[model samples]
Target chain A: MSHPTLQELRDQLGCLEETQRRFSRTIPIADAVDRWMPHGGLPVGCIHEVKGASVASALAFSSILSARIAGEQGNIVYIAPDRSLHPLGLLPYGVRLDRLLLVSARRSQDIAWATMEALRCSQVSAVMAILDSADLTSSRRLQLAAESSGATGFLLGPVTSAPIAAPITRWKVSSHVGKPGQRFDEPAWALDLLYCRGGRPGSWTIEWREQRLNTLFNQLATQTTREALAG
Target chain B: MARRFLSLFCPDVTDDRLTQLVEWCDRYSPLAAADGSDGIILDITGCIHLFGGEDKLFLDLQRRFHRMGIQSQGAIADTWGIAWALARYGEQSIVHGGNAASALALLPVEALRLPYEIVLELRRLGLSTISAVRKIPRSSLAARFGSTLLWRLDRIFQQAEEPLTPWRPAAPYRASRILAEPISTVSAVEYVLHDLLQEICKRLERNRLGSRHMDLACYRLDGTVDRCEIRTSKPTRSIPHLMRLFEGVLETLKSGFGFETFVLSVLDVEALHPTQLSLSQANPVEDESSFNALVDRFGMKLGFDQVNRIRVRESYLPEQAVEFRSAAVSPIAGAEWPAYRIRPVRLIHPPMSIKISILIPGGSPVRFFIGERQRRIVRLEGPERLTAEWWRDSNSRWGTRDYYRIEDDQGLRFWIFRDSSEHWFLHGHFA
Candidate 1:
């Protein structure tokens, strides 16, 4: 009957957000990985952070997530400070060059700002940001924007950076480049889900094939033998 | 049909004062052309009804000028030629449509807009007025004054006529407002633009029309113009969308010497019908109108050429498979993208030349160095031979290329190709 105060409106919005979370569609992972996710799979509207030991592994993980969301008919926005995510490099990971839009910002603050802007556009399915610095304030702003717009956001950062408490999920990926003199058929990745809201933390060694992660690459061909290589 | 044209002549007016005089005349009609350095002519054909009639309109205009402290002479005639002749030489007079020729005959030869030297020569020959020059035979007039004198006689006598080119083209839609005092602030410019847009959009709504291109003219107190233009791919009548396009444009402009008047003109328009909304689920941010606004905002900040849309091409060559096009265009319908097979996400243009050491003479590569990084190939997968038409003009660059997906010791994948000359080039990298 009367006009509601700002606090009461915020409380009402919280109730609406909780109800909306129940109806959100979950992205299904592989047979062994579903149980590890908070919603049995990744949530569509939440912020998911991925930290990698090296640039290669972190980029690979980001590409995998982008491909999954943008697969057949959606747009993916990548804002990077380092100008990575080469359209050529993502080809093997099943990401199309035409579907991805890349933005190269000179500063880390710009990358964070661009990520928030891209997320606010409902047409974009996912936003992958590579930033060296993101304080709690900017991260919270990005999170709020992503939630209201219903677009997923991923932060790809180094593993050694100090941890921030804004993202809902934190993941760390490490690359295993076989041995000094040998190379394997597939690149193996060690994915450690460091934290997830209302979910148990887990780790898995994943081998990217076709589109999703499946095998662990346990000596698929036993590194080329010297005599076999000679023949 | 008989139409009325008014010509105003302000003596000794030049530069800024002259332009300001012309700006003040825009109130009577939009088709007001500055006849010469000190004159303005208006096509008051259908506009006299607004201020009653020609007598009332001219009197009202004269009263306004008297109040503004600007002195000027005025005359009205059916043709611009006669009106121009009468306003300068004769007293304020209205020449009837059928009697314009006789009325203009007694005026001085300068009324024909002739060169001063030509008028002086005519006066020296005892022909002072236009009527005196008209008495001479046509051939002698041409022979003596080099044909221009004959042309001027014809114009004054209503024999041949010329059209007037207004300083600003008469647009189909235009709205303007004048302020009591000049404003030098940017916010004042926007406030005027917002009100003008509201007025123009109302008339567009009445006629079921939408404007695609518009221009904003700011008439400063110094009589100079600061103009900005906006264009949209689709015809739109929405005021907010148009205002959004002008935000960046307005920011870049300097208000410089406050403007006393603002005019918004619609340069191009098209018939637009109301759009029907779908009942099903829709994302608020990704609607059709918002998408256009987003593109317009991008064009505002960066540039229109920088925003691009991707389109699929049928060419089998990886480099030719997709093309980037201007964002204003719509993608070709039913043009399916070539299914992603083994294509790399990032392609190196012109194929970066590299040095490779293969394990065997005709076998896979063993080691390769691209740039400063050297990598040993641990696994190799191709020789996918692709050959082009030998008769093709561009095929002279390379006859054939064998593409291979090569992996190195660092778990990095590359799309490297070997040309007919047996040289390896890195074309793309795989994640």
Candidate 2:
């Protein structure tokens, strides 16, 4: 008898279809970046981290990501360290201020508890928590909670702090400079995928346009970027 | 049958002390009020059976007062007038129904709570006792004295009603539990609270009412009481939801020694219509309720103010553009935020002052040191001049602010402004 391949065994066990169904409910990040992820987008039911960005850049990126994952009518719970979120700035990122629940918790433990609570709630589609730092145990707990409820979690560290061991994907974001004479019509960021569970690392220069974060591939912008690889 | 009222008299207490004493007496009945500087009246009509009977209830009151170093007299009768009179003068403590006339027959006319001059005049007319006053015809008494005498007689005989203003408005929805063994542990308290919550929730459901605010009072073995309160964003009587709200609060309760009695009172209530679930399992109604429950949970853990929703305000100033409202409150349909304006994600309130070196007096900065690092502006936007709203506040001292959105060589953007005095301040950062 011939040995079955991994895909054939997975098909025979009926697990491949279930896995596809689970990963298929991805939160589409951007055009070029989604093609690089194994699941074609940021997978739901898991925690993702955004690091190496300034306070403003991290907030803008996470808010845009949260709005994309939440969709219309889905509630987004944001746990922040203070009452500093300007709702006006979020409008440009397609965030529905009406569907946003802001939880201001000062303590690290309180922030973790609130994030877990929001993740476990089926009513919430996305939970974005801005923390000073997060450890492995808390990150794992948050991941398990999101898995149980199928809600996407974004752990945003305003500054580039130490990385943790648990998030399925870790992203490093920095403000990307425009061409010397090119008009800076919109904000742009260089998103670096430093780690992925089942995919290779990649980089992209993305910008906000038409109420969504889209990949920027203009010759002038791509000059600063390294070679784009297909996964 | 007429309702019964209880009257207690403290000969030595003053007005302030009597007010406090009336509040303590609320445990006996819902309607407890301070009758005068020396007395308290309680409407214990159907509440007697709770303490076994009127005699037993009276004895309990006496025991409590004696323990508190007070010499008190108490009486129960068909009306507050009779109860008040009998508590002060009648030999019997409790008068049977329809026997108010016979009960006050031997008491002095002063027992009718008449004015001092009327009592003295009644004594002068040889009509000192209530029975002696009753001997005179009603017309004759009305002719002799004014209507005050007749009104007082009618009140004593249960012919007129007098309303008593209670010290605290008793909650219509309340449940209490008296533990056989005082509980000191948090788990035990939670168990008792769960039981009480079920009872109250049933009542709320039956009446189609939901409570927005609830107060839990734990009567400790000592004289003091420990209380904790929980409030929801919307009216709710869900036992599990309410129990979750109490989980964090129960731990903070000081069960010094132990708590013997627990009372949960619904402080605020609103009509909550029954919802009809759709045939399809996934509906927006369920999601809305669960979202509200999540907000309530966070509000209970943190303060309600800590859980907020941002609302846009109609103001020109950046700082006055938005306000944070507690999530527990229903959002008022406010003005929709206009298309995305050039605003920073994080606005540094009361813009921090920055040291700048400008080549031209009214021009943009050549270099500014944010902390110790010097930043050279690579790209500069504008000198968008915004004048102060002098019409809004005439006392305003500041004039115009020349704002600029500038990016440093590292591509870091800053929203800075130059005031009338040429001082530059960093207001916000573009994301």
Candidate 3:
């Protein structure tokens, strides 16, 4: 019949609040790529969009993100609806299939639903949802679910001509041709910062080499004019 | 003697899939139990010899489950706690007995399930591996690392006892057959079922026991499996009784293209004491086992959810009431009703908001607007006020709720509630 003590009340409140705080919040990634992301880390409870000109470029972008997030301990849930990805192809990029969970959803809507469910788990570090054809309502629902779960989602889709409102940072990727007469020429990649929160919107051309993307914008401009004149 | 164990960690399990995984693990070993959020502890113990040695047994398990399309990783060790630790943290398989100590030498001290902050502190002190921490003095380790860590480490190293609560008791009799050629026809299935029944009956007769329940599992060629189980009203080892129970179930098997193997296991067997037979009841005309088999077939054909049992809980709160669980898994044995507080049958998913006009000491509501219709309250029950758990951020803005079971003029009863200040909402209805 007596009122509960102050310490008892504090204990009850702590017990109720402990469930949400039980999740591990560390962003598992390699030290090198972790330095490039904002806050020196990928922001939790947000979405990152990867817009690519071709399927190959979209896959490459996803592989890079997957390798970065799935560095040592944490795992990546790749929800692929459009294409079947070979696990061996991603190994060289540092994504171990043992640590990577591939969920093949039949429909685009199911991918979003599964992604929402995957994000709720504290064990999953990041989710790569290949949104081949997602409408605005489903995309909004995904964004809300990602926010609630405190997990980051990478929305990978084709580059549409029409501009769409994205929830987080959007990067456009395109393949570039390499220089001639080079035995081990670098793989070219052009990245456009289409949309970013409080970040600069600029373009950067990079060549994939030695487990890192090297900037080749200044070097490519001079060679382009000579090739144009020769043609 | 060397003891072998298998620990499974499946982290991708959602809220709905956890029950299925638990049941699936029960098929492999009776000692299986849930570990944390996404792990299963299995006690292989003396059963490893059945599938050959430990390595071959692990491979056989992996291949069988892989064929079933469920991804899993397993580790074997000398102790239950160590097996649990290595399955989640170790890079390679930790072999049991001989190499357990060497295998555990390279693992991090956090594998002992110590607090995260303590592990961080250990890392900061450059004490990263289990071997490194083992070098410290026992007294110092006990003082600095806390008694819980020491106890867990001792349990893992086999210096302490750690027993497992098994999923089911060990069954005494079991029979299995591996087909040289996969059989697809119903007659072939019946032939195999008869062979299995004969084998089981011989074993039971030698032991002088009768089975209460039996399980039949058909491992198909295409990796899908079908299971048909039957429970008897009394202890039975009769071949005719068993064959009749499996009669109708054989027609429903798809064969999944065809079955490569079949296994039959009997459980809950009791010693059969001979008694004088009555003439009227000798070999009863119709057995209850056949009736149960028919219900099982119908339930499997219609869907598992078609058969259900009502489960009641002990609570004064109405919404904490009763729930219906599948008859196959519900813990309620023999459908005995327990004494519980009466509660309304109908409950809304999300309580609907309503506008109300108060008439008393400005307390209780006389009338309320529910959707487009207005209803007048005839009598009001006692108000039971409840508050939300404010510690949850999702419910931070939730106010206090006062509930009342009200009767309307149309003789419809509603469980309505008012908020901390006087706002009303229709929470549920009485059936």
DockQ top scorer = 2
* Runs off by more than 4 Å, candidate 2: A1-22, A179-185, A217-231, B10-24, B34-39, B49-52, B63-71, B88-90, B96-162, B179-181, B221-224, B278-289, B383-400, B420-422
- The model with the greatest TM-score is 2
| Per-residue lDDT of candidate 3, residues B1-431 (tens digit) | 75556887767766445545554555456566777777777787776766677788778767865776667777888888778778888876657576777787888878877889888988998999988988888899788877877787788888888878765565677787778788989899889999999999888878888777788778765444577877654466777767776775778788867887777889778776544555786454333323233233323333334333344444333333344344344245332222222223235556678888886766788888888788887756747766665544554343766788765665345678777666677766442
Residue-level lDDT tens digits of model 1 in A110-173: 5665677777777777787776766788778877877877778888777887665578888887
lDDT (10s digit) by residue, model 2, range B1-431 = 56989999898987766766776676678788989888999999878888899999999789868867888998998889999999999989999876778888999888989899999999998987999999999999999899999998787676787888888788888887767788899999999999999999889989999889999878766435678999999898888788888987888998888987888889899998778877776753534338788898899998899999878887656766788889988897666665634667777866888989889876668889888889998877777777777667742434677788777877777888888887888988787
Ranking by TM-score: 2, 1, 3
**Residue B86 displacement in candidate 1 (angstroms):** 5.8
**Candidate 3 segments exceeding 4 Å error:** A1-231, B13-22, B25-28, B65-71, B91-94, B178-185, B219-225, B252-261, B274-431
Worst 10-residue lDDT window, candidate 2 chain B: B280-289
| DockQ, cand. 2 | 0.53
| Candidate order by decreasing lDDT | 2, 1, 3
Q: Which pairs of residues have clashing backbones in candidate 2?
A: none
The TM-score each candidate achieves on chain A is 0.78, 0.83, 0.69
How does each model score on lDDT? 0.70, 0.81, 0.63
Q: What is the lDDT of residue A119 in candidate 2?
A: 93
